[model samples]
Target: MLAIDETAAARAMIQISRVAKTYRTTDGEIPSLRPIDLSIADGEFVVVVGPSGCGKTTLLRMIAGLMPPSEGEIRVGDRIVTSPHSDVGIVFQSALLLPWRTVLANVMMPVEVKGLPREIYQPRAEALLKMAGLGGFETKHPWQLSGGMQQRVAICRALVHDPKILLMDEPFGALDAMTRERMNAELQRIQRETKKTALLITHSIPEAVFLADRIVVLSERPGAIAAIYTVDLPRPRQLDVLGMPEFVRLTTTIRAHFNAQLD
Candidate 1:
């Protein structure tokens, strides 16, 4: 059994300590992520940003328990995450919905997989879809929706399980710039209303600066923490907040950290 570390319980809802990942292939052992230490408080929105292949997705997958770390451990709340848990929800770049299934059906897939009664989870799924602005579209198929609408369904699906932590890997990366910005605002609104802890992995620094309470920057290859910047701007942030002087300053600081890693 994994022992619960009291230090990990300090302010964090999730604690990652000295975690590393390596893949063994015919050629050799390739290190994807170096040992890393990170703590994310309850209800905090943390965005991990870096260049492609910097192991941002690897780190998020490790936290989601989709993959195990080669070393160290990951803890969520009081329990160690050795496998996938109901308390965690994950959304990837693609919506990946079932074409044959209706939006409501896709949202309720997890509840069904968990063997919960349909009657119980059905209402919850409906509510999540409504909250995500797809209330009337629940009967539509993924093929019937726009890119942004499909991603909205994806977000709703992740939350339908009512997970305490949401792990998103470039959820908005496939959308156009305008749609991405709209989804970003929508995400903030949902996070504010639900107060769920979220860890998002993205390559866009501006997106990271716009959405996160704190931005964690990582270096290339055997990824390591390069820097962490706290976004001090006030909450209930508007889309206009992106234009503020403070927002520019913070993004500039984060960009500098990324550039430094490249040097």
Candidate 2:
């Protein structure tokens, strides 16, 4: 677990001021996101959902500093994001684990790429695997694990570096329905345990409601914030919470936004 900085905890861990993205090609210019502002506080779990090509991934990529936004700026804590940031960790839809690397080796990839001593991060990587329920499977290959398990390994890899913020782009979108639901529960537990500021992009309304402290909904192409809903559910949420009236109400409300767009 990361030691909390008393002063840093007082401010939003991520701040976006009118951030937008556009793709420039010889053929034409394409706008993906409209200028929008959002702030994610320390340890908050925020989920972004929108129709396909609504720029959810684009927004997440900008926040991770993997790409630059054409408009405005993003700040992680006090630092402006101009290039890839050390304080952020990212996970995508695919596990993307190397075929030959052992699960533990895959988890430690970031630590190695950053040139951090393996001796120090080795135990941390092991501990993260254990936390993600892959303790005994460290020596196994990625192909040996189920899709859900592979995603768990990916999550462990992302956290192995002890990043202050976690950015996930449909991290479980490829899984079977049952597996995805299970992964959702596992993710909620992990996020709660680590208290890392998380921003996840998902297409599942139920998944969004299940994991988010707050949910940010985006509009159609050239996406902009449509609505932000506070989950208001109690902590340590279990799968049964999905059946609650409030959960149903929230999902229905959020679904309405997309439905309206279609009409």
Compute each candidate's TM-score over C-alphas: 0.95, 0.95
Candidate 2 per-residue C-alpha lDDT over 31-129 given as tens digits, one digit per residue, 9 for 90 to 100: 999999998999999999999999999998999888999999998999999999888889999999998999999999999899998999999999888
| Clashing residue pairs, backbone N/CA/C < 3 A, model 2 | none
lDDT of each: 0.90, 0.93
Model 2 misplacement above 4 A: 1-10
lDDT for residue 31 in candidate 1, whole number 0-100: 97
Shift in Å, residue 214, candidate 2:
0.6
lDDT of 1 by residue, 105-192 (tens): 9999998899878887899989888888888998999999999999889988888878999889999999999999999989999988
Q: How far in Å is the alpha carbon of 14 misplaced in model 2?
A: 0.6
